[model samples]
Target: MVKGKATLALELPLPEEGTANTKQERAYQAIREAILNGLLQAEDRLPSTRALAQRWGVARGTLESVYERLQLEGYILRQVGSGSRVSAVMPDSYLKAVIDFGVTSTPIGEVPTSNPTESVRSETVHRAQVGMPFVARLANPQLMSPAEWAAHLQRAMARMTPDQMCNAEPQGALALRQQIARYLRNHRGIACQAEHLLITNGIRHAIDLVARVVLQPGDHVVVEDPGYPAVHRIFAEAGASLVYAPIDEQGLDLSSVPEAVHCRLAYVTPAHQSPLGVIMSATRRLELLDWAQRQGGWIIEDDYDSEFNYHRAPLPALKAIDSVQRVVYCGSFNQALFSNLRLGYLMAPPQLHNQILALWHTVGRSVGVSEQLGLAAYMHGPAFLRHLRRARQEYLTLRDIVLDTLQKHAAGRYRISGEHAGFHLILWLTADQDQDLLIEAAAEVGIRLQPLRGYCQQNQLEPAFVLGFAALTRAQAKTASLKLAYLLQA
Candidate 1:
């Protein structure tokens, strides 16, 4: 009854032989209502439990107990030679919204309206319109103090014992890798120890475990021409081949990276060069560490938001002069202490620390040992440098109230670069304005901005946006920089 070529042709109906339902529960409710109405999608491929028990005429052990209850209820994904499919990630990707509450015993697909409280208030107003400011200008968990982070998670769960509440360390919690290896050897000089750190759940899980332990499918990575589009979809989902490479005024343009494209990896941020905030210059960080030592390549160095430097002093870290460990050094406290404190760290380069801790033990501990012993007791105390000197003097007075309200109302119609450090800045427009109608009139007053050609892939710089004043509030940063300087002077 089953062969190889008919993957899916679902037309399930059954239940009529004197019914209380069972042609294997009406073919497991018509294959879970054809995978919750999308008619079987996410990764698709289904049909061969003996060709769906000869197209539902039944008994191949009742379609193998209806695919062993849709693969034990996560709704399909079997494997062992790659057979049953449908579960690329769908335990419940919404679709069950059928309200009609007139209750005819409320059964046939049981109506339970108020769609999960209007789908959690439309996903909390789309996460408060993408955490506003210049859109995700993060770090404002109402400037810390939830009873000082629940008294440092109540002294890291009152000094958890009994084998630290049943062991966990996948390469984390060696007292938070000895306080992130003594805060990267006294602030980013990066001599490194604590077995060359690992702990991640940020910098996109350390570039998805260094693009699955150093990419291979067509290799060549480079990236950073108006970068960080989720590290170009995590190195094009690890099948690699990206290249881009162009951000100047001294950051990533290492002779436009194409000397016969052998580049195994490069993803830089050289301290402050995402969304165009240039810094990488120490002679383009020794010409990108001599093009990663003449192409033996590998250099992630995200250093995300280099501790909010309002103006000066904060360079060093290209894994602090890597003398050939060819840097992997990423860092994050979820953008310093509050973007749900997801925590982050990477260091690596001890010849790829056991292949990045064996692909971080197959992606298990994305971070948890009680939020890594409450961020190693708030980075071994002084309450994380007194909440990074009161959130760097309130994000350096909201980056001088968004640079004196966009230089007193968008003077000479926009051009400001990286504002000396992080928590967002790069305005740049004036090519006869209209960067998407000034980002849809700063999203009709609620403000979000974003577009620098949506972090480009083929250098088309200028005509910019990326604003973020780190969760604004100096009267919402002078009324969102005078409503984005009256939409860049209309």
Candidate 2:
């Protein structure tokens, strides 16, 4: 008889009393067959040993052996509190079975780990939408060459001594930090030592850490209206009372912020604000800094996608001018290099450095050592600069093509902004057109139009679409624009 805990919700097939193999083998084969047939899906939790044993009319000890074997063979994942789940990356036979079923799977949205195989089937289908092009989706093909990257990885691994591997610092490898320091000083004009810098998984992780270190429950945090939606969620999860600040042509409008609420932190994407591509003016940047200094608050300068400015020389980061160290600068390679490389850095004020470090150790430690070192090598090498130059030029051509197409085809129907920098631009739909209906029309014509309203928290802003042209070639953009123009005209 099965013993100990009560039964779980997981259902499992039972074997007959007089089976050829032992009850244990019968259960194993049944579960294995279920997985191979795609009936037992990946990440599916299994019935507890006690429950399964009771169902099989076998000893709980017998069921334990079966589960141990399956776990050893990489059939399922076993964790302390979470129970067992089917492994996401299955064996070749399981993958073959999935392929035979005529199904396809795409791993969604930069979670982490080895890319799940094309044959690997997930319960949820993540169909590709139109907004993917405008976003920093993936790394360039030329930059991700296996041969070249392997060489860099080899060099990075060789550079790591045995002692360097252990006692891994929560901040990051000093060597890599030094390289990042030099790169930032030369490229972004934000001067900082290795001590002020802390490597994070990405911008989101950095924001989470900052929230943990600086924010308390119900503390006010200022976020841009119609901003990156993810930022709103991050601060909210940290127990912040969010106050929305609207954006103008000069970037985040400080005038819009309510004076009654004392904000402890202000998050800004000054270099290139997402959805609205306005560069914050020098005067506005100074004003923002002054407010932070006066309020005794911190500014998270998200310098994402600042590298691909086309119209003029990129403006210096707010951190560059922050003599008072009120700015906590954040940058990520996900936009510059690839989305999968979730490597980003946080530059904190010296006063908050130790607190941030403490919070990181508790919540955000265990950054991939190889990735840090590999990125360090790539940054130090000539390829980094060479790739940037090529990407900048290519994006410029694509941007011009998009601008010309919109002006020629959809003119008078929409207002465009964000042409100054970044891979995307905003097209505000005029005449109070229904954004949902227009987006559906674009999709029908094989054009993916990202709705601007989706980014807004308060829904007080005008309806717009953020069009991304960087990923599309001249021909692709031209074709897509033709379809979009036709719909807009009607």
Candidate 3:
């Protein structure tokens, strides 16, 4: 493996003069200090053993021994080809014990995950039970045959060598990346090698990494107005100045992108616009590509909810038409497998491979090795395609039940949109009321509807609410839609 530089400069501490400890002991102390002081963060890859050993003037065997000790103690993770990374799940008490005392005999326990995205699953469940919008069961194992999944997992585990289990590549498991690349090429018309892909925690994580690597503070970027709110928050956190581009029936309005502001990046959900559910026109996709090529900017094509199109064949991803390597494709398994899975991948230009790998290492690697291996096995098997097919049909049925019930009960009262694809549809209210009040009233009756205005960062949109159907049963949809219709009319 190549010894790569980290985005964040990490200085290894040198031993003190006349220190009684041996070279190995001093090296261990320095590394431990780096982790405790936050110089080496969770999932940050350490320099190659050869490079570090040579730099510190220590024998390779000595470095190996130190690495082994750290691995055994749960301070770092080591794999054969992937080198070592600071343990992301290291226990907090271990750090406290180490810091308080000169030495800690007891190893730290596993650190709890702090990913906010993972918390969404809990919210999804609570909302789903109340028949709320944007709610989906998180990878309910029941959806797949338990015996089949267990068999696949066992096979995946058996195929793994000890090294493969210990340390996972920052990019992702090679087998999984290969399968993802193949799947994309076959299904989405995106042609790319496995190396061009990097597995992320989710779309947010992928977007954040791309924003950080491709954008500078105050750089102008285009975003879909009344789109996925999370996109706005992610870009803002990266210090990018967002220019809202409105969307119509055809998706992101290219004309709205200000000519004066030189856009460095554009985040778009082309397959099905996040809340609006409009496919971007082919002409628009080409025009966006032309804009990127001209400005030397990048387009992040978020293929959100692309798999569940109920109409004709899904449109080719923007990346499929991107000849200049200006489009970075972001996709996730959350919608496919389960929301709680938190597995997403990015396909980028070859020139960005090294930089993205570095950024991912620094940002914090997610998707554990076991999960990656198991997912790879699942994808490789027949079950993945089968599940998607079944899910599409099931969602379609649920969507119809909700829409049919709403139209029958609330006919001519509100305008409905977003029936072409995805798990939810929008209802534009004829009688405008405070969105919060509507939400509160609905919640009082045990329903949760997401207001469309909440998705907009700057653009003014009509009052509407999104009703998610994928998580609702036929009975739930029928009852909730009738109740919702009556509530709106009342």
Candidate 4:
């Protein structure tokens, strides 16, 4: 008899009477199960509490309890005059954003945390959540519930030996590089032999290694404005002068890039651009390649979300399009796979493999043999692809759930940006309202979010957030969404 039940269900025969005292509880359970199972669509109206009670033969008071629980769970919406509706959000994206928060180099004490699990989750704790996740860009692999990835890691580790860790982890650990290579081939269209690949800590380290070999102080590099801050920051730290290009729907506006930042480097997220979530069109991809070749600038193609592309099979990474050795295409399993393992590689100019290996030797020092070995074993083994496929499916489910639920409950008031692909979603802030108040209210409701303000370049800009989904369970995602929708009303 919960008031939040969806109106468009198949109308199964009502449950038998007397099994539960409070028919409202029974109603809530049924409706919640229906929503979780995707039996209802977004914007689907719900029967009033009275109507639901009549259907279940429960008193309206009992029905009220059911509605309260649904609201708490973020599975339903309630209004003074409006009826309750479904909650929406991208759970998998939120999970990844939580994990990535840890990958970047941040001041240690700056991250707030009392709970170890959350401490492990945010790169910085007390990190806010909401429509502003792009600004936060916090992705936490550690936050991924171990219970979920255990079976996959277990299968991969079953084959490992103690001696493996004792030995020096190779250029690309036989198992992991191979596993990674295979995935890149199948998913992102990265073509390379396992031997040619050099596994490193994460994409940042990989980028750093490349920076070491290819970039020198005063080097001019073109980057996207409002692009991945990590990329620009790293290059800037390495003494590279950057020409920041404004990004439009077509991707990075090369014209906006000053001629001065025209050294051999440019970083681009082609599948879905970071923060803004714009995919690079084919024409723009070729134009970028042409620009790189003509200017002799090295194009660092970041294959961040090509794996989870919702629009179509992912575009072949920009490296695949290179006839010249201009594309230093880099990607990592960190985003697609869980963290706790630093497994990512770069597909470089064929001649630069040895130089890249040499650079890793001097710069990063070493990566874990154990993680590399385990991930490799998974990659080579049948289960590796299976795990990816499973995650891929679940990520889509999480994305759809978030998008559908938000559209259902909030409608035109709150708008969602980004694509159906990727582990995270970006919600644009149309107004500069009291974002802090909104976030605080969300916490009061027991749902959490990271605001986009943290990801902003400076105070002069508006706010946004990079909500992740890889860690959150479907149930958790649904509950989080309902709480978020209520907050949106404020």
Candidate 5:
């Protein structure tokens, strides 16, 4: 057997006076330079915390802190039993190459190009293409079993009649509408019949139908400040003037709504406030319903992702408490099941049923009969509940992993909110930190984040970012959290 070469201790130079402000900074710079200059190869083991502390004449705690910073920055990897090793891929390699063309090191899995400009452009594009964490409505596709869905589709197809194939209902298939009514009654606590529901392509389509039917040119519409941009666009395109309402800890602040403003429609994500994630308080919910009833206005309750409530039993939907029939309850299977399916439904008020159906007939194409039938069949069977249970458990695990890692690694660096429900949560940063810079830094290391300001209109909310946890795996949650914590604390 060949003898293995004995590993040698890393010999880093001590900090000189006036060179670095502190020993920690100096030591950090030195080790970072070693890795960047190829003096320390990837996967090379480093001395233990105690050994390094004694070797460098620093406290063990200081050495541990240094290692943690290095690990957080992706320059090193630390395992409890296996000790610390240089990361297989270095972030500095990419940063250095982007800053100056002096470094020729390529990131792992990237192809090297001879043209410097092309390489930089390609790298910039690649960074832009990184998976962003705050993307809303994203779910782990792996959690959904495609084979089972396909089987349901096959069954629906086999049972399809010629009349059903040739003729499609404008209000969607009866079976699907009936199933959706039952689901809403049971899960959302909304008592409504199949006639109250209209099968829509998604929330956007549902909003569009409501807009065309209800909104007049120059009609005043009340929307949440940090609300869904698509809703704003839809109403705007319909020639409606949008009045912004601020969101508070209790959800959309009804007090902020100008009492003088006679709004025709108020669009809200009451179950899970978009971007901020605070559920509309019970008092606020009643207040909103009263506002609509008194003002003769309508409320579009977009219950986007209420299925994955982790901490407490979910509150009844806003539509559940609408006694005056002023609320239109909208929901989608796309977020819960799959995005590509494009299946959503809305429970319209009885008065607008005919008008909505008429407008839908004019503007919308029926959702595929097979898809509607298959989904109806799926919802009726046991597999759908099993899928929900599995997905909820997986999402809950991911949420915990993210929350725990962030709290442990980056304590006091940030504040968290809207974590009790939904696929994403708000990570409010300190007032002094630049949200954009942190976002840019995160993207450089292939961790994408969205600024909370992007979703707001007029309200000057705190500097924060929305962090989605639904699709992250165990390893991804830890790594991304560490990187994010480093960016915030750095």
Candidate 6:
């Protein structure tokens, strides 16, 4: 009955202005916009008939008519004790659709999701519609334009011949590995060959494979303090000690790299640093490679969004710059194609390839061989690069919309970073700000964004969040920005 107890959400997704003919419909749109815009969110008890009527400067009956309209649209549910509570969002079928498109033919539950770090959000909720928006990986897995890739996908399916179905190559389809290698060499400037590439069931498998190969229990690993925490969790489960280092404006500050570096593995998003969005300078990249090579350490390069740079083409991947062969390069089709695709790869030097592949065989358990063939076909056929071109444009447009909206809406309370590439961005709250409390406040009104606090290391730095823009339409981004701004203003 009171806003005191409930989850915060964005103001509801509203119908557009002037789209509905009746006053009730118009009022419904208004209230819906408020909810979608985060002006009104879940469990925030609505004003009574008289209060709503007075606030809108409308007759009581007219307000009644509007509330009734919202109820009919399933925007709110009324109960005896709880006068009117915002309705949970209607689940979109994109997640299910992607699942059906043949990634993990054996349902996810059957496989146990390989990685233990998958939370309620990763498993149960596929598309992040309105709750605690995570910025590291995109929430909307179906973010790729299927219609655009329809031709490429068709080529892939055709390539999935019965011969491909009969056998499972532990190293993945040879053709696919070759395709990936060519793509990397041509696009990222990384020198890879089919011999070094191992395909697995997405990033989880790739990360797990890396963990199994490089890290021993209790081994120390250097992790960026404000980098993706989900990753740190994986390394921990693998029994590694995560040594935290703060990320600065110029990418992660390695100024403090210990002379006696103890970690066996170090993870960095050097191309466009996660959360911070700054590109690592070529000089720093050389130093980092040198440090790892000298220490006999392995660098886990999560080239998450190296393919989606905005201001310029992405920097050469660390793997490309390395003569030392210390970089274990990993990436996925999750960002470019879809999340549930479960298609990611790890490429290591020939020296470490067997161990990495053995880890892949041990942990991956099963691979989506058919999808790999399809992806290989897509990559080689005329459609792959073409699809990427269109995707880049759409993704960039959405990013611009996000920037414009944040600039227009979150004027005083927020500062955005890491905007040049990737699916998400980071917003650093003012020094005096309380992100935890502010996140709760945001929920009360209906806008859900991840607070940066969860991503930080023990008692370090100010709070910030990683947020994705690829999943939202430009219009929705604008509305979300406005909603977020309202919360900040409050």
Q: Each model's TM-score?
A: 0.35, 0.70, 0.71, 0.65, 0.73, 0.69
Question: What is the TM-score of candidate 1?
Answer: 0.35
lDDT (tens digit, per residue) of candidate 1 on 1-490: 2333224444546556543235765676577556544566667778777766776677888778777665643457778777787762322212222122111221111112222111111111112122466675778777888898888888998998878778876678899889889877766646788877878888888888888887766676777887777667767766766777788776787677657667777888877888788876544565565566556777888888888886543555777656556678888897788887788878877678778888788757757788789888888989987897798888888888888887887789987887877787787877787787776777788886777776775787767777777776778877878888878887
* Candidate 3 lDDT, 1-490, residue by residue in tens: 3334342223575587444247776676677557654566678788766777767788878888777656643457888877788773323433343345322122212222233232121212134332344344223333556677678878899989988977777689999999999888767867778988999988888888888887766677788987776677677767666777889865678787755567788999988888787777544565676666556678999997888888644655778656566788999998787777788999887656678889888767878887788889999978999998888887788778878877788788788888878877778888555666777888888777777776766568888877677776667777888888887776
Identify the leading candidate in terms of TM-score: 5
lDDT of 5 by residue, 1-490 (tens): 1112113334667668565556766676677666654556577787787876777787888777777766744567889888887763433423343245332211112122222222111111111111345453377787888899999999989999999999997789999999999888767767778878889889999999999998877677888988887678788778777788899877888787777667788999988898688877644665676677656778999999988888644556878656567788889998789777899998887777789889888876758999999999999888877888888988888888888878887889899988888788888898788877887898798777777777777788888877887876767777888888778779
Expressed as tens digits, the lDDT of each residue in 1-490 for candidate 4 is 3334355532634455553334644575577546544565345567777876666666878778777665543456688777877653223322232334322221111111122122111233233232232222233343344664566467656766777646665486777667666676665545667776777777888788778777766666677756666666678677766665666766776765544334567888876787667766544665676566556557787876566766545655667546455678787777666653566788787656789887777665566665666566556656556655676777677677777777778766566677556767877555845667776776677655666544434223455556775456677667676667666765
4 versus 6: better lDDT goes to: 6
Q: How many residue pairs clash in each candidate?
A: 1, 1, 1, 51, 0, 15
Clashes of 6: 15
All-Cα superposition RMSD per candidate: 20.7, 27.5, 22.2, 17.9, 24.3, 22.5
Candidate closest to the true structure, highest lDDT: 5
Q: lDDT of model 6 at residue 15?
A: 48
RMSD versus native structure for model 4: 17.9
Ranking by TM-score: 5, 3, 2, 6, 4, 1
Candidate 6 root-mean-square deviation in Å: 22.5
Task: Indicate the residue-level lDDT of 269 in model 5.
Answer: 92
Q: Whole-model lDDT, candidate 4?
A: 0.61
Candidate 1 residue pairs in backbone clash: 134-468
The TM-score between candidate 2 and the true structure equals 0.70
- Model 1: how large is the Cα RMSD against the reference? 20.7
Q: Write the per-residue lDDT of candidate 6 for residues 1-490, one digit (tens) a residue.
A: 1344332221233345555545555555566555543455555667666665555555778767666645533456667765677763411221232233322211111111232233212311123442233332463434456665666556667657687777677788998999999888767767678877888777766877888877766566778866776687788788776766777655566667665546677899887776677776533555566566545677888888777877655556778646566788888887677666778888886667898777666654566666777688778876677766777887788778767776776677878777777777877787777777777876676556676565665436567766776776667766666777676666
Q: lDDT of all the models against the reference?
A: 0.71, 0.71, 0.72, 0.61, 0.75, 0.66
Give the Å shift of residue 231 in candidate 2: 1.0
Q: Which residue pairs collide in model 5, if any?
A: none
